[model samples]
Target chain A: MHKTLWREIKKEKNYLLAGKPVPRLLILNAGSRNHLIRCFLKSWAEQGEIIVSDSYPLAPSLYEDCRSFIIPFYKHKNYTEAILDLCEKQKVTGVLSLIDPDLSILSELKTEFASAGILAFISEEWIVKATFDKWEMFKVFEANHIPTVKSWADLSEFLNDVKNGKAGYPIMVKPREGSGSRGLHYIESEETLISVWNNAIEPMLIQRWIEGRELGADLYFDIYSGELIEFFIKEKLKMRAGETDKSVSLRDEKAENLLKRLSRNLALYGPIDVDLFITAHDDYLISEINPRFGGGYPHAYACEADYPGLILQNMQGKHLTEQKIKWQSGHYMMKFFDMVFIDDKTRRNAGEEIKQQEEN
Target chain B: MHKTLWREIKKEKNYLLAGKPVPRLLILNAGSRNHLIRCFLKSWAEQGEIIVSDSYPLAPSLYEDCRSFIIPFYKHKNYTEAILDLCEKQKVTGVLSLIDPDLSILSELKTEFASAGILAFISEEWIVKATFDKWEMFKVFEANHIPTVKSWADLSEFLNDVKNGKAGYPIMVKPREGSGSRGLHYIESEETLISVWNNAIEPMLIQRWIEGRELGADLYFDIYSGELIEFFIKEKLKMRAGETDKSVSLRDEKAENLLKRLSRNLALYGPIDVDLFITAHDDYLISEINPRFGGGYPHAYACEADYPGLILQNMQGKHLTEQKIKWQSGHYMMKFFDMVFIDDKTRRNAGEEIKQQEEN
Candidate 1:
C-alpha cells in the first residue's frame, strides 16, 4: 500500500473524534461534465477545495482557477489506484463522479474509500447495477408499485400483445441497456417491427408507446442520514444529444408524490435522476432511474433546489431540513452552445497527453 | 354573380333556421399539414364531412376515404374564387385553412365567406399583420405590460447597449421581419457582431437572448361568442426545422395568466398560438404570437384541451362551457415520422395536377 493510504487509514479513526470538516472533493471525469463543474464552482467552492480530474488537459481548461489533474481515463486498469493515490495525497475527504461508467467503478470501491476516511457519494453496487440495467430497473419499478410502460424482452411477446389488441401499433423498440436516445426506434406497424427486429441489437426491449409529456425529476438523498433531502421536477421542453437541452421546472403534485414514494423505497444515498412520462390517463409511468447526477441538474439548481449545498452541509455533519429542498417553480432552462477557445499549440498538447495516458 | 353563388346567398341566411350543421369542411393546403388534418379527422370528423384540398393530389391522399380537391395554391389569383365555387357546389359551410400565407387571404375574405353563410376560422387582418410583423408584435407586448426582451433596430443603439451592459455578448441579431429561426445569429463579441451586421438582411432587430426554456401556448377563442374558450401551454422540448418537433404540455400559473391576459386583451376570434420564454427569474417574456393553428397544437389536443371541440361546438352556435376546456396535465407528445405511400402512378398524377394548377 502507498504510505499516504496507510496514513489516511490511521487518520480515519480520529476523523470523527476530531470533528473536522471534509478537506477536499475529488470530481472524477471532469471533462465535459460542465453541469457538475458549474454547480461546484457556484455553490460548493467555499465548502472545500475542488479537484477535478480528466484524461486531457483541455478538459481542465474549462475551469478558471480550480485545481485540475490530468489523470488516466476510468477505463484504464490503473485508474482506481490513481484516484486512490490522489485522494490520499490531497486529503480528499469526499469522492464523487459525474460520468456513467465511473459510477459503477467508484461504487464498487466505496468501502475502500470509506476505509481511507473518505466518503464516496455513490450508491451501493447493487443500486448502480439496477439503474444501468434496464430490465433490472423495470423489476425494481414493479416491486415498488411504480407504474411503468409495458415492456417486452422478446419480440414474440410484443407481437402477441399487438395481435390481441392489448398494445396497438407504433410500439417503441430499443436496446435494453442503452442510455440517452441511442438505438431507439418507433415501429409503426407489424411489417416495420418485423423488418427491424433482426437488425436490432440483441436483448432489446419493445415498449408500449406512452402518449404524453416527458418529465425529469432530479433527486438527492442525504449520504449521512440516508433520507430523501431534495426533489425537483422539470418538464423536458426540448432535448438534444439525449440530454435535456431545454426544460421548465414545474411542481406537479402527482410527480412529487411519486418521487417521495420512490425515495422511501430506494433508500439510496446521493443524487438519483429519474425519467418518466405522464400518460394521457394521467398516470406517472417511470421509464428509467439513473443513479447519478443528470444533465438537467442545472435546471433544478437554478430553481434553487441546491443539491450541492445540501451535500456540502451534510458533509460537515449537518442534517437536511424541510426548508433545504424548497425551490421556485416556473423557472426554465434553454441550453445554448458555448465555446472555450484554445490555441493550436494548447490543443495539440492536450491531444498528446490523452494519447500518452491511453498508452500508459 | 354566378348562379350558384346567388343560390348559396339565399341558403346562407336560412342556415340558422334550417339548423343544419356545417355540411362540409374544406381544409385548404391539406398536404404537409398533417397535424391539423389529424386533429380535424380525429375530433371534428363526426361534426362535418371533410373535404381536403391541396395543390398537389398526394397531399389529400394521406387521408383515408375522405373527399379531396386539387385546388390551386391560395396565392393563385383565382384561388379564393375557386374555393368559393367549391363551397357553392359542394354545400360546404366551414372554410378554414392550415397554411401560413393563406391565413391573411382567408381573414381578408371573412365577410365574403359570411355572405355565402360559411364560417372561416381566421383572425382579423390586423391580428395577422401584428403577429407576422415582429416589430409590431414587440410594440404590442410593450403596451400590454408583458415583459419582453429589449430589442434594437439600429446597430449603433445595440452597440451602445452592449457597452452599457444592458445587453451582454452573444446577443441574437436577426431580420426584423423574419419568421421561424431563419437569419438568427448569435453574435458573441463586437468583432463577430460587426462582421454579421453587414451580411444580415436589412431592417434587423438585435435583442438580448432569453436564457431559459421556450414555451408554446395553444389557445382558442370562440368566434361567435368572442370569448377565449381554451388554453394549453406546452414547453418546447425539442425543435426541428424551426418548429416544435417534441413538446410536453405544462400547466404553469404565470404562463397561464399571461396567456389569459393576452387573450383577453387581443381577443383574436380563433386559435391564437403564442411563444414565450420563462426566464431564470421566472418571468414570462413574450416572444411572438401566431394568429392561427400552431404546428404544436396537436400536443395540446392530445392533452384533452380540445380547442377543435370548442371551435366545432361554436360553429354549431353553442356557447363555451368550462368542461369543454378541461384537460389532463403532465401529458407529452413525442412526434414521430409517419409515411404516406403513393405509388408511381398516383405520384405522377399528383405532379401533373400541381403543374396544371400552376399553369392555370
Candidate 2:
C-alpha cells in the first residue's frame, strides 16, 4: 500500500520561510532527463518556471524550452561561478541538482544560495554525505535499525563469509561512492568475482545480492514544514539501462512506517528515493538512498503523488494542511524514449552564440 | 558526400506503382517506438495515415494519435487472420514489420497482401531469411564480394583459427538467428570463449572482432523504382543499451559505394540498415544487416536524409531520380528518453474498452 491520497497535515512551524512569486528553479547538471524536465514543467507551469544547466551543450534536457545555461563541468574551476552567475542572472528562486556527485556540492553551497534568496532543495549536509557513500549508507541504516542488505568494503571479509557458506554466488560488486549501476558487477562464482575484483576500479564494495521483486519509493519531506508529506512506492516489473521502465503502484503499511521511521531517525529533506527489495520470504531490506528525484519518479507523479507540486508548495512557503483527495492504486507506468531533434541551422547558431559568449 | 537533397526527376516507367489517395499503412507489432511513430506521422500527415498493430497493448507506440489495433502475436494461429481482418477494416494499403523474426513471416504473406492491393515492404523471402541469420549473412556478403568480417559457425573451425594465430581473442559470439545485441558475448580469451560457448544458446557464430569507431548507415531503396533513394551514415560516438545514443554525421564515399553495391546485388527492398566498423587501417567491414529502419535513423532524418518521406514517396508511386540540396555534416544527434504518461482513469478505460472488444 503506497499511495492513499497523501494523508498529511502541516505542523505549526516555519522552515526558513521565503515565498516568492514566479519562482524559477535552477536544475543544475540536468543531463538528458527530458521526461523529468517535462514533469517539472507540467507542475510548475502555472506557479513558476524551470532553468536548466549542463556542461554538455547536447544534453537533451537543456533544450526543453526552458531557460538553459551551458555551464562548465563540476570539476572545472569556474563551475561554481558559472552556476551562481546564472542563478543571479536568471533570478532563480530555487536550486536543485540531478547528478549524485553534484548533490554534495549543492549541499555545501546551501548557505550561499539561501543568502541569495534561493532555497536549495538539499538534505542536511551530513545526511547527504553519508547517503552518497554505499558503506556509510549501510552503516546509517544499521544504526537506525532500518532493514538493510549486508555489505562489505573489504574483499577478504566478503570472501570469508563466502567460504563459510553465509554468502554465495550472484553477489554484487559496486563502487562504494558512486550512484547508478556504473562500475557494478554481478558475480556468480569465486573465480569470476576475483577476476572482476582484480580488474575493477578501486574503492569498490561487495554486497550480498538481494533477489526477488524490487520496489522504488519516491518520497518528499516538506522543506518548509519540515515534515514528510509525500510517500509513493511501486514494484519494479522491468528495467532498462538500470532505470525502471515498467512498474505497478502498491501500498504497504509496514514499508511506509519503516520509511517514516527512517525520516524521523535521519534528516532527509526535499525529494529522496529509496531502493528496496522484498525477498521471497516476504521480508524487505533497504538498498540505497538517492537524495534527489529518482528516475522512476514518473510512476509516482502519474499516481498523483506530485512531488514537484509539493516542492512548488514549499517554494510558496505554503504547506498542505491535509490531503483529502483519493487516487487509485495498481496503475502501471510504462516508459519509452522520445527525442529532441535539433536541426542543422539551429544547432550551428546555438553553438556559435554560446562560443561567442564564452569568448566574451 | 551525404545529405545532398533531391536532384531527382520521376522516371517514366511504372514500378508496380499503385498510388492511391489517403493511403493507410499498417505498422505491424508497433512496440514502444514512440519517436519512430512520430517520424512517420510527421511525414505521412499530408499523404495518408499510419495504422499501428501490436501484440502488446502497452506498446507506447499504440497510444500515439493514429488508428491502432491490438493484433495477436505473430506466432499465434489466428495472427494472419487478425492482420488480414485489420487490413480490410482499416483499408490499409501498405504493410511493414519492425521486428526481425516477423520479417520472414511478412515476406511469406507478400502475395496475399499484393492480391488484396496492399503492398508488403519486405525483401524477397530468401533475402529476408539469409540476412536474418549471422552465418547465412556472412555467406551472402562473401558471395556478393561485399567487405565483411569473417565468421565461423563451427567451433572446431574457430578454434583452429585461434591456434593458427589467424583470428585472436576479443572476438564476438552471437546467436546465429537473432537480432539486436541480445545473447551477444564479447570473448577476450580462449578460456572465456570456451566457457561461454559451452553454456551459450546453440547455432551460435564466432566472429572476428574489429575495434575502432563504429559507423551506422541507414539506407532506403525504393521498391517501386528499384533504386537506392536515401543513404545516411553517422560515426557512433556513444552507445546506450547497445543502441546508438550519440553520433556525428560523416560522409564516406567508399562506404557508400560498398552499401550501394550490396543493395544492387541483393533483392533488398524498402529500407535496410548496415552496421559497419571502420578499422584503424582505414578500411571498413560490414558487421550485420538489419533489414528495416535502424535505431540511428533519427540522426539521418535530422540531417534531412528523410527516409520516412522516401517511403511515403514509394507509397505515392513517386520517386526521386537524382539528389540536390544539402544538410551540413559534423552535426551531432543525441537521443534521450521522453515518455507517454497516461493517467490511471484513461489507462483502465482503454484496457477495459479493448477487453470488451475482444470479448465481442
Candidate 3:
C-alpha cells in the first residue's frame, strides 16, 4: 500500500514538472448543514468544486448551491452502498469523511480505491483508531515524549491513587468517545467520583483537569514526510453542551513551538486539535488530540489562512509556498440564540393582562 | 459575502457541537497536485473521509472501492465547466482548485455557492491576481517591504545599468506567465540581453541572477488572518525542460524564518513558492512567489507534512494547530524515468546488430 502511494506521489510530481495542470476536486458530505464540514467544504470550494448530500429530509439549507440529494433510506440502511451509488452516478473524483463512525467504513473503501488506482485518503486505520481512543493516543504521546495530562484508564486504580493522595481531586471524568462535554463531571471528592462513575455507563478516562479555559491549536502535518505545514491557536471562551460559545485567535511563539514538538513526536498527519491547559506555571499540558477539523476552523479562515486550500494541494502532491496569514487578535464569540414564536392569541392575552395590571 | 460566510461557519459549528457527523471530501488533479489542497484533503480524510481524483483511466483500477470518477474532459476542455458539471451531477458537497488558472474561476463561482449556503472557498481576488502574476507579485512584495532581487521592467534600462557597471551581468530574464523556467535565460552581457529582449514578445521581468542553485520553501498562511501556519525548505536537484530533474526536501530553521518574514510582509494566500538566494553575506533575496501549489509538494509529503490538509481545515473555519515536521535530511532526489515497450522482433534486430558489431 505504501509503495503504491509512493508511486502515485512520484507520478504527480512528474506530471507537475511536465507543466500539466492538476485536476479539480469534489467534496461529499452525509450531513448537509454541518458547520465544521461546511467550513472545510468552503475551503475545498476555494480550490475547485463541491456537492452535498443529506439523508434527512429536513437537512439544513445552507449548502444550497451544492446539488443536494435525498437519501433517507441510506441513513440507517446501507450507507456504503448509498455512497457507492452516488460515486457511480456523479463521477465523484474523490471521497472524504468528517466523522468518526465513518472511519472504518471509509478505510474499507480506501482499500478498494487503492486497488482501483483511485486515491482514497483514509489515514492508516491503526493511527485513526489509536488517536480516537484517548488512552491509545496518550500511550503514543507518552512513548514519543510528548507532554500530556496525567490520565488513568481504570477508575479503581485512579480512586486508589486519589485515596493515597497521589492523585488529587478536581479531576475530570468523561466517556472515551463522547463529544462536547457530554456526561463529563468534575469530582472534588471520592463520593462524587464514585457517584459519577456509577452513573456513567460509557467507558471513561480520568485526568486532572487543566486549569484554564480550553486553548487549542489545530495543526496539519504530512504523515508520509513528517512535515508541519500549518497551524492556528484559539482561546476557547465558552463551551456549552460541548460546544465553544466564544473564542479568539491568539499568537504565541511558545505554544507554537510546543505544538510543533508534539507533531514531530507523534508523527502526526491530517488535522489534529491539541487541547492544552495553560497553568499557573505558565506551562501547557497536552489534553487530547481531536483527530479532525475543529469547530474553530472559521476563525483560521477569517484570519486569512486558507488551510483547506493547503490540504488540497498536499493531496495533489504539490509543495506549499510560504504564506502570510492575516490573523486578527480580538474577541470573536460564537453565541447561540434560540428563536421562539408566540401565537397572536397568546400575545393578545399577555397584552391584556399587562394592560389590566398597568390600569390597576 | 463575508457575512454569509460567517453565518455558514456558525451553522457548521452548531452541527459539530450537536454531534452531527460531517462528510467526506474528494480531491482531483491532472498533473502535479497542490500541496495545500492535498494536506487539507488528508486532514479532512483523517477525521472524515476523502477520495482523490485520478488523471489516468487506469487509476480507477487502482482505487476500486473508494469513490472516484473519470472526468477525462477536465484535461483538455473548460476545466471550470467540467468541475461544476461533475459536482452537480455527482452530488459533491464542495469543490476546490489548487493551481492558478483554476483559482480565478473558483473565486468567481464562490458567490454562487454562497447564495445557496453551499460552502465555496474563494481567496481575495486581488490577492490572487497580484500573487499569481510574477511581476505584479514582486511589486507587491517590494511595496510591502518584502525583500526581493532588484529587478527592472525595461530591458534597455537594465542593460544600460549593467553596461555602466551599476549592475552586474549574468542576469535572469523570464516572461510574466511562463512556467517551469521556460523562456528563461541567463544573459551575461548587454548584447545578449538586448537581443533576447527584442525577440521576446511577452512582457518580461529581469533580475540579477543570484549566484546560487534554486532553493525554495513551501509555506502556508491564513491569508485572511495573517498568521503563518506551516513551512518547509527544499533544494532543487536538477532541472530539465523547465522542470526539476530531482527535487529534494530539506529542513532549515533559518530558511523557514526568512520565508516567514517574507510571508508576513507579503500577506500572501493559497500556495506560495518563495525562491531565495542565500547570499555571501548570509542574506536571502526573494526570487518570486508562485501563489499556487508548486511541483515539489511531494517532497514535503514524503517528509510527512500535509499542507493541503491545513488549507482545507482553514477554509472550513477550523482552528489550525501547530505541527512540528521532522525532515529526513539525506539527499532525496526525484529522478524521472521513461517507460517504453519493444516487441520481440525489435529486440532480435537490436541483438543481431550487437552481434554483428561484436563479430566485426
Candidate topping TM-score: 2
- The residue-by-residue lDDT of candidate 3 on B19-117, one tens digit each, is 543443445552223233344444555454343453433221112223444443344666556556555543444455444566666666766755633
TM-score of each: 0.48, 0.83, 0.42
DockQ of each: 0.01, 0.41, 0.01
TM-score of chain A of 2: 0.86
Chain B TM (all candidates): 0.86, 0.88, 0.72
* Cα distance off (Å), candidate 1, residue A69: 0.8
Off by over 4 Å in 2: A1-22, A88-90, A150-212, A281-285, A316-326, A344-360, B1-22, B150-175, B182-206, B316-326, B343-360
Candidate 3, residue A360: how far the Cα is off, in Å: 72
Candidate 1, residues A109-143: lDDT per residue as tens digits?
A: 99998898888898878878888777788788888
Error of 2 at A141 (Å): 2.5
Which lDDT tens digits does candidate 2 get at residues A1-360?
Answer: 111112111111122225424666889888888778888989886456777778787787766766566778899998787778777755678989998878888889988988998889988888899987899988898998898889988888888987898887788988888766788888888898888888875688888877677998988887755577778888887787788887778788767777777654577779998988888787888888888998878777777888788878877767654353344557777777666666556555545534644765
Of 2 and 3, the candidate ahead on TM-score is 2
Residue pairs with colliding backbones in model 1 are: A212-B332, A213-B331, A213-B332, A237-B236, A237-B237, A238-B237, A238-B238, A334-B212
- Candidate that would win on lDDT: 2
